[model samples]
Target: MTSLPEDSPPQMSEDDRDTAVQRLQEAYAEGLISHEEFDERLHQVLTAEARSELVSALASLPEKHPGTTSTIGAAGGRIQRHGVWRVPRFLKVESAFGRVRLDLSRAIIEHPVIDIELQLGTGRAEITVPRDAVVDVEGLRTGWKDLRYNAPRRSGPGEPKIQISGTMGFGRLKIRHARR
Candidate 1:
């Protein structure tokens, strides 16, 4: 494999380089960068060709997302919710500065066959479900603290079980599921 040039951006510190790469990947996945832009910038970073390009890309990313300022409820913080509860799929909730609390206390249960999945990252996450909701959780990984679960006993015959798998860093995770 070819190597980076000697004068490429002073050889960024390992930690700084890793953080930049992670941010770039997250921005690409969140649609902040187009496929072509992502590919070109990733190539530049990997080959150490245009370090300034990476900086420019990172600077331009936040401008595209336009942070919102709405409060979710008694949560007393900014909570942005996306996706609908229709089918079994993935739900990703992320934050950098504040905690994320998912209060499913008011969710309407029309069908007794719904499955919920969650992915938490970089912040505290609290998920609350009702006593009769059937949930299967997966990929639950946390950092800085152990994952905690709290919920009332299940009212129905079937227990709401959680199948967790994933990793969290520098934060705590609390999953509240009703037990049968």
Candidate 2:
């Protein structure tokens, strides 16, 4: 990993190029990428196209180790769960500018109440709730024109409803709430 200043723009150094090649090799070995395709893509990564693609791919990769809090938005982004361990629960998610991923499939709420408030400058946001959870949406403004919203089906819900209300902007917002 090439250690660059946090504020530095996304540019690949010699070390970064080597790291990308290494990852590509690992991916090929893991069957995620074919040897031939990996060689072709590796060439591309060493060229100009690698700049944006590599940065985006790296950004989307999940954190390797757990319990490692990211300082990217350590002060502004948080997930607060308030209630007892019952069939129903209340979850409030608040973010100034960042992306959020929620999995309600593993949740054991009899009744689920969700409230979301997002102030996204140029970030992405996502929310996933049980299909039985009621959904309410509002207040979305985007700085750019490429805003996206995806609402899928519910996976599992013993007996819970979901409610959502919020405003969004030029970013993205996805909600998979219950069908109430």
Candidate 3:
């Protein structure tokens, strides 16, 4: 067999290809790419032979905002997030007399570690994390109610770790791992 050139582009792995596909899907959902463009780019990402080819397919997509925190607050209404929405690295959620439910089973969480700070008053908050996630509630403080969470038997290597903190007033905070 012939040796490859030194200047050749690096070969794309399955994980790289999967990440490229997820980027294209996110761009399409955000209306950054039209149907035709999404289809074309998706084909390119799937068939990409090198990392450069995959990069070209994902070119022009805006990078995630660094050092920016996403906040969701409700005074008396419910707050919910599920499906394939993007999950930022830092998230702050506040609800006063409102129920908060966050389902991150199918979320696009690019960060290996996510920090969620919650401030709630008199309303229950439920968070369903990814199955492989390792949750840390050490910084969470509760008044008049206990946090309900059963730690997993074991967390796998390289799985995302979610750090939840902040205060809860007169309302229970429940955390559960999503089922496979």
* TM-score of each predicted structure versus truth: 0.40, 0.37, 0.63
Give per-residue CA lDDT, model 1, range 1-180, as digits (tens).
Answer: 112233555546554455456557656645567889878766666655444544554555563222221122222244543233322222344455466766555544343333333344456766666556555444455567787864444456653333334566777777675332
Flag clash pairs in model 3.
none
* TM-score computed on alpha carbons, candidate 1: 0.40
Residue 149 miss distance in model 3 (angstroms) = 0.2
Ranking by TM-score: 3, 1, 2
Looking at model 3, report the run of 10 residues with the lowest lDDT sum: 1-10
Better of 1 and 2 by TM-score: 1
Best by lDDT: 3
Residue 38 C-alpha lDDT in model 3: 96
Better of 1 and 3 by lDDT: 3
Instruction: Name the runs in model 3 displaced over 4 angstroms.
Output: 1-67
Our model 3 lands, by Cα RMSD against the true structure, at 14.4
